[model samples]
Target: MTQENHQKKIITNEDLFDHISGFKLEVKKTVDDFKSEMKESTNDLSNSILRLESSVEDLRKSTLEGFDMVFKTIDDTNSELREELKNDNIILRKEMNQRFSVVDKRFTIIDDRLTVVDDRLSSIEDNMTYKHQLSPKFA
Candidate 1:
């Protein structure tokens, strides 16, 4: 009976140690799985950020091109307007000079007629003085 009791009591600390070791291995596997899932999530977020950045850059370039085209159109319009104004000014000056020349010619003709009238009046005054000197004396 004593020998049989010794054989049944053979369960010892080594068996407990084996059970604890198996439980630790399962916990380590769970931690490794969680780490792999976090790495995948981070990679997805990085890809989305890169795509957003590229889209923003494209928008900026398109906006700059539109503004450049508008500025060039305004400059062209301004240049055309300036040229038209210059042509109008030149035509106005030419017309004014022609009118002034016509007026000057008319004034010169009037001045010549006035000079002839002055010479005729001077001869009439000389004939009246000669008649007064030849009259007979009064009694």
Candidate 2:
């Protein structure tokens, strides 16, 4: 009876030890799985952040390029307008000079014709006076 009781106590202790070891192993596996999932989540978040940063950089570049193009276009338009105005002013000045030249020439011609008429009238008057004086002396 003493030997049988000793054997039964030894078997119970061995079974209890096995159950405790299995529970500890299961707990360790669960903790390891949780750590792996957390690492994957952190990696996914980092990748998302990197992609968002890249997108923001692209947007900034595009916006700057658009602004540069707009400024260039405005500058080109302003230069073209200045050139057109300068050309118009030059043409206007040339037209005014031509009109003034025509008027000056017309006035010079009129003055020359008037001087010729005055000279002819003075010559005729001198001849008539000389003829009248010679006739009275002959009579």
Candidate 3:
């Protein structure tokens, strides 16, 4: 009976060792599967980030292009307005010069008429002084 008990104890120890080995293999397989799943999740996140970055870049470019077009149109309109104002200023100056020329001609004619009237007044004064004998020679 003692010898049989020793043999049974030996078999129990062997069975325990086999169970431990099987548990080790299962743990290794579970760790490998977890690593693969984590790697796949990380790759997916990286791809999504890249796509989001690309979309943001595209939107930025389009917005800049729209702003550039608006600025260019404003510049063109400003240039046109400046040119029109210059033309209007030039036309007004020409018209003013023409009016000044006509006014100058009218002033010259008035001056000539005033000179003739002054000559007539001087002759009348001389005749009146002689008829009245109011000169120094008559006194």
Candidate 4:
């Protein structure tokens, strides 16, 4: 009976209130710490996202600049090639015209020589016919 009485526990109102108050304080502290850690983690994630976005934007700008340079180079090269082709075409036309003029002059000279030779051959034929009619040996 004495051991059973010693084993029984007694709780006072003041002691219970104090214990409950202390437990409430500990729980509030734990909750505040958890909220603070979550806030820090959220801020870190946001910063990482911002950095990734900035890197992507920078890469996009660089790629566009590179493309612009390539297009400009192509345009400049095309313009130069077009101008060169035009000049070559002009030069070729001039050379062909000069050659054609020289050919025309040669043909004119040949035509004149052929006309003179034809006249001479006609005169020789007339003289041969007269000789044949008078000599009577080529009838």
Q: For candidate 2, lDDT tens digit of each residue in 1-139?
A: 9998888777566688898889889999999999999999999999999999999999999999999999999999999999999999999899988988888888788788877877777777776777777789634
Q: List the RMSD of every prediction in angstroms.
A: 6.8, 8.3, 4.7, 3.0
Count of steric clashes across candidates, in order: 0, 0, 0, 0
Q: Candidate 1 on 1-139: residue-level lDDT in tens? A: 8899997888778887887888888888888888888888889889988988998998999889989989999999989988998998898889888888888777887777777777777777676666666764521
Using all chains and alpha carbons, the TM-scores for the candidates as numbered come to: 0.55, 0.56, 0.62, 0.74
Off by over 4 Å in 1: 1-37, 109-139
Please write out the lDDT profile of model 3 over residues 1-118, one tens digit for every residue.
9998887777576698999899999999999999999989999999999999999999999999999999999999999999999999999999999999989988988888888888
Which of the numbered candidates is closest to the native, going by highest TM-score? Answer: 4
Tell me, by lDDT, which candidate is best. 4
Name model 2 segments beyond 4 Å from true.
1-26, 100-139
Deviation from native of the Cα of residue 76 in model 1, angstroms: 0.3
* lDDT (Cα, tens digit) per residue for candidate 4, span 88-136: 9999999999999999999999999999999999999999999999997
- Which ten contiguous residues of candidate 1 have the minimum total lDDT? 130-139
Q: Once superposed on the true structure, which residue ranges of model 4 sit more than 4 Å away at CA? A: 1-23
What residue pairs clash in candidate 2, if any at all? none
* Comparison by lDDT, 2 against 4, better one: 4
